[model samples]
Target chain A: MRRVLGVVGLLLLWEGLAAWGLLNPLYAPPPHQVLLTLYGLFQSGEILPHLQATFTAALLGLFWGVLLGGSLGLLAAFSPLFADMLEPIMLLLNAIPRVILAPLFVIWLGIGLASKVALSLVLVSVLLFFAVYGGVRNVDPRLVERVETLGGGRLWLLKEVYLPSLAAWVLSSLKVAVGFAFTGAVVGEFVAASRGLGYLLSFAQSTYNAKLSLALITLIVLFVLLLFFLFDRLERHLLRWRPRGRAESQA
Target chain B: MLRVENLTLGYGGVPVLEGVSLGVGEGEFVSLVGPSGSGKSTLLRAVAGLVRPRAGAIHRAFPPEALGFLFQEDALLPWRTARENAALGLRIRGWPKAKALEEAEAWLLRLGLQGLGDRYPHELSGGQRKRVALAQVLALRPRLLLMDEPFSSLDAILRTGVTRDLLRLVEGEGIAVLLVTHDLEEALALSDRVYLLSQGPRARIAKEYAVPFSRPRDPVGVRSDPRFGPLLRRLWQDLEEVALCAAS
Candidate 1:
C-alpha cells in the first residue's frame, strides 16, 4: 500500500510542477499526459505491431542466447584446454560495446526482426556466459569431492553439482538480461527498422513529439516490468529451497 | 578391513604426512586426533581416494562403492532436500528415483529425522543437518566409513548426543570407521583405538593407544569410567611432549 502511495505521490508532484510551469511541460510531461497519450496510441491500434515485433525479437534472442551461452559455458568449465584458449577471446568480445554491433547486425541481417534478435542475442549471451562460467568455477570443491567419493562420475558431477549451480547464476542474470535483451531489440530497430518500439522512439524523437516519446518509453518500461515479474516467478519456483527472509524476520 | 602402509602425502612437493600407517578391522572404530593442520584430514582424504599419497599403499577389502566418507562440512547440496541429498549416492549408483527416495526416507527415519525429509539443508538445525549427512553416508551401506570431524561444529551437548547416536548406528551395522578429529575427548569416547599426530611439516603419528572400553559404551558411562580421566591426562601429556619436541 505504501509502495502504491509512493508512486502516486511522485506522479502528483510531477503533475503539480508541470501544471505550475516550475518544470518544462514540453520536455517533461506529467504522468497523466503520458498515460493519456499511451491510451490514445492503444485505442488507435498503432502501437500493437511495434510492440509485438519488439517482444517477439527479445524473446527469441533470450531463448537462443541462454541455450548457447549456458552450454558453451559448461563445456568450457569441463575442458581446461577449451577454457584457456577461448576465455581470453570471449573476454575480448564481451568488452566490445554490444550497442556498437547493432548497426553491423542490421547491415548483415537487414532491417528486420532478424537483426534485432541477433543484436539482442549478442547482448544477452555475453551476460549469461559469464554468469555460468563464474558459477561453475566457484562451485564448492568440497561438494564435488563429496560427489566423487560417492562413486559419481563426470555425468553425475554435471547433473548433481554444476547444473544446479549454473541454474542459480542463470536465473539471477535473467533479470539483468531481460533489460539488455529489450535494449538490443530497440537499439537494432533504432538503427534502421520500419517497426518496433525503438523505431517509434526514433520517430517520436525526429518529430520532437514529447508526448509520444514519453508514452512509448512508458509502454517499454511496463513491458520490461511484466517480463521481470514472470522471471521472478520462475526464479521462485526453481529456488524454493532458499530460506525465506520473512521467516527469519519474524524470528 | 582397510590398511594404509607407510603413507606419505604432501601438496606441491611439501610433505604433510610422513610414513604414517594405520589399520581398521571389521567393526572397529579408530580415530586420529591432532591439532589443526596436523594432516589428520589429509590422511582421511587419502584413504577416501580424494588425495593421492606420495608413497603408500591403501588396501581395502571392499570396492570403492562400499566405502562412504563424511567431511567436516556437511557437504549437502543446498538445493536438494534432505531426502534428495540422502538419495544422491543411490541415484548415482543407478537406482530408480522413486526407489532411491523411499530408501532415503527410511534412512532419514532411522536417523530420527522423521517428517523432515522435505526440508533443505538451510532449513535444518545444525544437529539435524549432521544427522542428514550421516544418513547420506550410511544409506550407501559402506563396510568402511571415513569421517573428518563430523561433529566439530555442534555445541557440546548436541555433539555428545549425535556422537552417541552415531556410535549406536555404526556399531549396530558392524561398519568399520576411521575418524579424524581435533577433540581428544571425542576421539577417546568413541574409538576402539586412537592415534595422535604431531604438528606438521611432515607430521607423523607420535603415539597410539588401544581404548580398553567395551563395545556398546554409553558416552556418559564411558566418560565416568575409572580409567577415562587418567587415560585423557596421559594422552594430553604425551601430546604436550610432542609439541615441546616439535618446538625444540
Candidate 2:
C-alpha cells in the first residue's frame, strides 16, 4: 500500500508541475498524458503487431539460448579441454557490452525477427554459461560421495545431484536473462526494423512525441516485470526443497 | 568378512595411518575407536574403497555394491524426500521404482520414522534424518555395513535409542559392521571387539580388546554391566597415553 501511495504521490507531483506550466509540455509530458497514450495504443489495438513481434523473438531466443548454453556448460564442466577451448572466446564476447552486437546482427541476419532473436540469444547464452559452469563447482562433494557409495554411476550422479544443484543458479540467471532478452529484441528493432516497440520508440523520438516514447518504455517495463514475477514463482516451485531465507538476492 | 592387513593410508605422500591391521568376521560387530585426527575415517574410507591405500591389502570377498557406508553427517539428499532418499540405492541397482519405494517406506517404518516419508531431509529433525540415513542404507540389505560415527551428531537420548536399534537390526540381519568412532562407551556397549588407534601423523592400531558383552545386548542396559566400567577406564587411559606419546 505504501509503495502504491508513493508512486501515486510522485505522479501527482509530476501532474501538478505540468499543470502549473512549470514544465515544458512538448519535452516533459505530464503523467496523465503518458498514461492516456498508453491506454490509447491498446484501445486502438495498434500495438498488437509490435508486441507480437517482440514476444516471438524474445521467447524463441530464450528457449534456444538456455538449451545451447546449458549443454555447453555441462560439457565444459566435464571436460577441461573443452573449457580451455571455450573460455577465451566467451571471455572476449563477455568483455565488451553485448548490446553493441545489434548492428552486426542486423547486417548479418537482416532487419527481421531473425536478427532480433540472434542478438537476444547471444546475450542470454553467455549469461547462462557462467551460471551453469559455476553451479557445477558449487555442488557438495560429500553428496557426490554419498551417491557413489550408493552405487550411482556418472549418469545417475548428473541427474540426481548436478541438475538439482544447478536449478537455483540457473533460475536466478534466467531472471537477469529476461531483461537481457528484451534489451536484445528492442535494441535490435531500434537499430533497423519496420515494427516493434523499439521501432515505435524511435518513431516517437523522431516526431518529438515524448508521451508516446514514455508509453512504450512503460509497456516494456510492464512486460519485463511480468516475466520476472512468473520466473520467481517458477523458481519457488522447483526449489521448494531449499531452506527459506537463504537468498532473496541477499545471498 | 573383511580384512585390512598392514594398511598404510595417506594423502599426497603424507602417511596418515601406518601398519594398521584389523578384521571383522561374518555377523561380527567391530568398532575402531581413536582420538580425533587419528585417521580413523581414512581407514574406514580405505575399507569402502574411497581412498587408495599407500601400502596394504583389504580383503573383502563380497562385491563392492553389497556394502553400504553411513557418513558422520546424515548425508541425505536435501532435495529428495525421505522415501526417495532411502530408495536411491535400490533404484540405482535396477530395482523397479515401485518396489524400491515400498521397501524404503517399510524400512522407514521399521526405523520408527512412520509417516515421515514425504518430508524432505531439511524438514526432518537431526535424529530423524539420522534414522532416515540408516533406513536408506539398510533398505539395500548390505552384507557389510561401514559407519563413520553415524550417531555422533545426535543428542545423548537420541544416540542411545539409535544405537540400540542399530545393534538389534545389524545382528538380526547377520550383517557384519565395522564402525569408526571416538566414543569408548559407544564402542564397549555396541561392539564384539574394539580396536584402539593411537594418535597420528602415523596412527596405528595400538591395542585390541574383546568385549565380554554378549549378542543382541541392550546398548543402554549393557552400560550397567560391571565389566563396562573397567573397559571404559582402560580404553580412556590408553587413549590418553597415545595422546601423550603423540604430543611428545
Candidate 3:
C-alpha cells in the first residue's frame, strides 16, 4: 500500500512539474494531456500493429533465451571442460555493449522482427546461463555426497538434486531478464525497422508530439510492470516451499 | 561380513592411515575410538568406499550399493523435508516413492520423530536432525553401517536420547556397524568391541577391548554399572600418551 502511494505521488509530482513549467512543456507534457493522448491513440488503434510486432519479437526472444540458456547453464554446471571452452567467447561477446549490436543485427537480418528477437535472445540467454550455472555450482556438496552415497546415480543427481537447488536462482535471473527482454526489443526497434513502441516513440519525436511520446513511454512502463508481476507470481508459486522471506525451496 | 585387510587411506598424496586391518563380523557392532585426527573417520570412509583405500582390499558380503553411512554431521538435504531426507536413502536404493516414504515414516516413528515429517532439517533441533539422519540410514536396511562420530555433537541430554535410540536400532536391525568416536562412553555404550587408534598421519590401532556389557543396554544405566567407569578410565589413560604423541 505504501509503495503504491509512493508511485502515485511521483506521478502527481511529474504532472505538477510540467504544469509549473519547471520542465519544458513541449518535452514533458502534463500527465492529463499524456493520458488523453494515450486514450486517443488506443481509440484509433494506432498502437496495435507495432505492438504485435514488438510483442512477437519479445515472446520469441524469451523462448530462445530460456531454451538456450537452460541448456548452456546445465552444461556449464556439469562440465568444467565445456565451461572452460566457452569462457573466452562468452566473455568477449558479453563485453560488447549489446545495444551497439542492434544496428548490426538490422543490417544482417534486414530490418525485420528477427533482428529484434535476435538481440533480445543474445542479452537474455547470457544472463540466464550465468545465473543458472552459478546456482547449480553453489549447491551444497554435503547434500550431493549424501545423495551419492545413498546410491543416487548421475541422472538422479541432475534431476532431483541439482535442478531443485537451481530453481530460485534461475527464477531471479528470469525476473531480471524479463526487463532486458523489453529493452532488447525496443533497442532493436530504435536502431532500425518500421514497427514497435520504439518506432512509435520515433514517430512522436519527428512530429514534436511530446504528449504522445510520454503516453507511449507510460504504456511501455505498464507493459514491463505487467510482465514483472506475472513472473513474480510464477516465482512465488514455483518456490512456495522456501522459507518465507527468502528463496523458497522448489522441491 | 565386512573385512578390511591391511587397509590404508589417504587424500591425494597425504596418507592418514596405513596398514589398518579390521573386520566386523555379521551383526557385530564395533567401535573405533581414538583422539582427534587419529584416522578413525578415514577408516570409516574407506569402508564406505567414499575414500579409496591406498593399499589394501576391502571385501564386503554385500556390494557397495548395500552399504549405509551416517556422518558426524547430519548431512540431511536442507531443501527436503525431514521425511523426504530420511526417505532419500531408500529412494536412491530404487524403492518406489510411496514404499520409500512408508518405510521412512516407520523408521522416523521408531526414532521418536513422529509428526515431524513435514518439517525441513533447519526447522528441527540438532538432536532431531541426528535422529532423522539415523532414520535415513536405517531405512536403507544396509547389511553394513559405517558411522563417524554420530553422536558427538549433541548436548548431554540430547546425546543421551540419540545414543539410546542408536543402540536400539543397531541391535534391532541385526546390522554390522563400524563407528568412530572420541567419546569412550559412547564406544562403551554401542560397541561389542572397541578399537583405539594410536593417532597421527599414519595412525594405527593400538588396543582392542571387547566390551563386557550385555545386550539392550541403557546408556545411563550402563554407565552406572560397576565395570563401566574403570574400563573407561583405563582406556583414557592408555590413550593419553597417544594423544600427546599425535598432538606433537
* Candidate 1 lDDT by residue in tens digits, A3-35: 899988998999999999898878898889999
TM-score of chain B of 1: 0.97
DockQ comparisons of all candidates to the true complex: 0.83, 0.82, 0.57
- State how far residue A79 of model 1 sits from its true place (Å): 2.5
Ranking by DockQ: 1, 2, 3
Estimate the TM-score for candidate 2: 0.97
Residue-level lDDT tens digits of model 2 in A139-192: 999889899999899998998999999998999999999998898899989999
Best by lDDT: 2
Question: Which 10 successive residues of model 1 chain B have the least lDDT summed?
Answer: B238-247
lDDT of each: 0.89, 0.91, 0.85
Q: So what's the TM-score on candidate 1? A: 0.94
The TM-score values for the models, in the order shown, are: 0.94, 0.97, 0.94
lDDT per residue, candidate 1, B72-145, as tens digits?
88889989999999999999989999999999999999889999999999999999999999998999999999
- Winner of 1 and 2 under TM-score: 2
Give Cα distance to truth, residue A73, candidate 2, Å. 1.5
